[model samples]
Target: MTPPPPPCLACLLTLLLLAAAAAPPAGAICVPRNPGGHSKPGAPAKPAPPKPKPLTPAAPAPPKLTPMAPGADIVRSLCLKTDYPDLCMSAIAKQPQPQLPVGKRLDGAGVLRLAMGAVRTKAAEAKAAAGALANDPRTQPLARGPLHDCVESFDDIAYSLDQAAKSLAAGDRDTTGTMLDTVRTDVDTCDQGFEEREELTPVMAKHDAELAKLSSNCLAIATAAGLR
Candidate 1:
């Protein structure tokens, strides 16, 4: 056309065209083999669920209050049978100027009878307490320890009282005083043990209190009798 292009110029032009077609131009981005490789923006990962707290258990309630019986009645009964009839009677009879003859056999016999009556009353009370404990549901378990102690104490007292009665009948003041001291000690121990337990019912408390009073009275009587 314009004077046919030079052979070398035409070849060079062809090479340039081929190179331009194969290579990417400046400012152009290249695609990866696997397209859409990157994660989308504003798509947040899920948060882990919060850990649970530990549970606590409720506290147990305290023991309930038990009602007490009238202690005065039991006290009066014990005092009348044991303290007033036996100890007080003997103490009064031992006055420097006796109303009745001091050496009278009837006086000694009467004192022995009073002592026997007191011992019998103590034994009866112990048995009755045991029976009541056996029959009562609420007090049965709690009563076992205290009731056992009370009965054992009563047994000791009864034994001592029996010995004392024998001594009194034989006019052995020394032996009688010793026996009374022993009885008083046993009864005191039983009373103290019973008082410590919180499970005592009114009736039980009354019995315990009465027994304690009896113990004190017996101790006084033993001392008055010249034992301790």
Candidate 2:
């Protein structure tokens, strides 16, 4: 253009033209290929959605029972024959597990076994509860007598129920009935102890209700099994 370029300058210009021809379009951006396929460095980084929290477990449902009858359910079958069918059903169903025996049918003997087991377990629990009350520091010295008596009464009831279970096992229905009845009297005595002092506490009332239910359930079971 201005007197022909020098030889060196001419060679440089030719090289520059060749490089320009090999280049990408002027406005295009170049992105490097990733070897590991990870996300691009500055690409707005699409935020990942947060993970969901785990769900909590549900509580077990209580037993759903119809009116006691001689149909399929063994507990219902036996309880239907008792004086307090509803009470019997509720008490028996409160057990940790109420699975059927070997053949799934509860005969008179089986009824006795189940009832006696329930009675024994409840008697132990009642005795322990009463003992705790007796040992409580919150109770006044004068009011402690009734609670102590209640402890003794529950202990007596426990022993009586154990003996009754043995008599039932020995096939002595009359003796079993006698011991079970004696246990009812002991429960009343426990109540009378608190009543005499006019010191019936909330704890005592709760224990009384639970004890009454368990004892009544045992009595009803005995009646159903023809031990009364």
* TM-score on alpha carbons, each prediction: 0.45, 0.60
Candidate 2, superposed: residue stretches over 4 Å from native = 1-72, 94-104, 199-202
Instruction: List the lowest-lDDT window of 10 residues for candidate 1.
Output: 69-78
Pull out the clashing pairs in model 1. 68-202, 69-202
Q: Which structure among the candidates has the greatest TM-score?
A: 2
Off by over 4 Å in 1: 1-105, 199-203, 212-228
Tell me the TM-score of model 2: 0.60
lDDT of 1 by residue, 1-228 (tens): 579789999999999999999998899986544334454444555577999878777788888967532232332333354444444444333323224454533333343344345545755686577657756677757667776776677777778778877887777878877887776677666666556876665345565555555555655544443433
RMSD (CA, Å), each prediction: 20.5, 12.9
lDDT of each: 0.58, 0.72
